[model samples]
Target: MSRKIREGLLMLISIVLLATGGTILYRQLLPSSAVKADGAKSGGQLSVRHAPEPKADVQGRFPAQSVERYAFSQEGKDLFSLLVARYQDSIGLPQSAVLFPKDAQEIASSPTGLRHDIWQSAADIIARKAPENALFLSWWDDGQRIHYLSGKEAWLRKPSDKTFVGPVWKALQDSLPVASDEERARLAQMARWLTMDSEKALSEIAAHFGASRPVYLLVNNDLLLHLAEFTAYGGTSLSLDSKNIPAGNDLHGDIALVKRWAFEAGDGNYLAQKEGNYYRVWSTPDAKAKNTLLVRLLPFIDSLKKLPKGVSLVYQSHWGGFLSVYKIDNQPIH
Candidate 1:
């Protein structure tokens, strides 16, 4: 062979050897699952063995029955903590990923139960539309579910973070049967603050947390129904007398002393009269003489309709408008 051809052959041999060695090293560094084992001979053919099913780490873990029993126990703090931690680790998720299963289950099983599906729908919408770090502002009662399902931080994470309740109460007080436009304006201002969409409202909310961040507001039909409890009317327990007044009772004299207010309900106008046990509301003007509890709640209900200019209703559920999502347009205040 020529000397030049011999040298070229030697170089080609070196290149082949280097490539084989590099491939071997790469295989050795791969994960165990990536490495294949020698196959068994079956019917004159090599058959590769299927990967073994991974054995779950059952050690130091409670059985399914124990978990179920613990779920029903009164002192389940430890169990809940453990389950929440395990769920996070296993799913590679944050604490907000775990729905407040206990509360959701309880509500589902109640007589006046909320349909869990509705909550899931709302959560889905929030998760899709809300920014990653958005901080939700809502009644403290809804904090847990919002945090868990939406995977977002809530302003009212605990009962103690309910500083907004005072302002809400004041707004409710202003909403009472007073005949002053100034009182109504004050009530409107408080509503804006509670919704946290205006500059003043944002400043007040930021003061509580010591910083400002993106915020979203969630509302539902239950919120409308129980508006009084979230306002000044909620401060005192309501009681009713056993005496039933006639349907044609003089509302100005008999019912006006308690509370009387009108509000828009759906397409029609309605009046609420609250006196003693006779808390009744009706759309028909003929039923105006009857007393109702809804009378005191008209202001709060009306406030729900008056969102700030930049706040827009982005989502509404089909189920009796039970779920609503409002988005605040982030813009510089002129």
Candidate 2:
């Protein structure tokens, strides 16, 4: 097989899930209906399976060894660390990737999680832009990173009423008991808040914070191999489209390849971070999906030429996995 073809196939197979709490993430093979056999297999049928479960019950669920602290930066005291969960492989097995600083550069992008450097850099952005009293409304994970790295206050610790089980396991998930804390429940609504209509989402945010203090909306890159927590909690679905773009004799070929992927996905709203010659494209063909906050918030994937009204970009990291902070404008997106 050609190198390009081989890499595409591996990406198709290597896709995995998020390891937060009871989150079970796995990328299902794209349906055969859209298969393009020119140089592809598995019939081009890539669908996202979002299965987020129980909250991060560190003491109760995961073993001590499963969770470890990694000192990813020099900015912190001595060994300022972030708790990482290493649970399950591509097949829902118990095995996980127990990595060290040495592996940061190697496995630090999409299809994988952030590396030590990326974490520190993202934290640095928060430290610089975010004011001391600014309120952060993002996923719990980002909140923790913000609190740890920037020393800014974020509602990241109070275990949310087990991040709402994804669409696939709604019945079973609803059965799982949830804590009745209002703030926790509000936090749990992050899924709907993120994936819903932009206007309504903004309105909700306004209502929640009510100008009591400064609020910054934080989002990260969507080019992850695992089932993104945002899509899972929001029950959003999209096909996982993998491609092997030949970089030709230069970088121009690579750039063109990414552009083509964007065109195919109804604009640049559904792109995944490219991995060498391989690109994991998230295909959004529907109207509802086309208007989601997840797509618009992503830097390169946004369909707009520039950020629209009411949405201002505060910081965009060179690496998508790193966080992006946005300040809400009083006006609504037009």
User: Which candidate gets the maximum TM-score versus the true structure?
Assistant: 2
Cα error, residue 2 of model 1, in Å, equals 98
Cα lDDT tens digits, model 2, 75-173, are: 121211223444432234442222223233342222233444555666666677666678777766555445544556665433333443322122123
For all candidates in order, the CA lDDT equals 0.35, 0.45
lDDT of 1 by residue, 222-314 (tens): 433333333442222222111222323453443332223222323223323232234233332322211121222222222333444444566
lDDT of 1: 0.35
The true-versus-predicted C-alpha distance at residue 172 of model 1, in Å, is: 27
TM-score of each: 0.38, 0.57
Total residue pair clashes for candidate 1: 6
Candidate 2, residue 140: the lDDT equals: 60
Inter-residue clash pairs, candidate 2? 17-25, 30-45, 30-46, 31-45, 35-43, 46-239, 46-240, 111-224, 111-225
lDDT of 2 at 93: 41
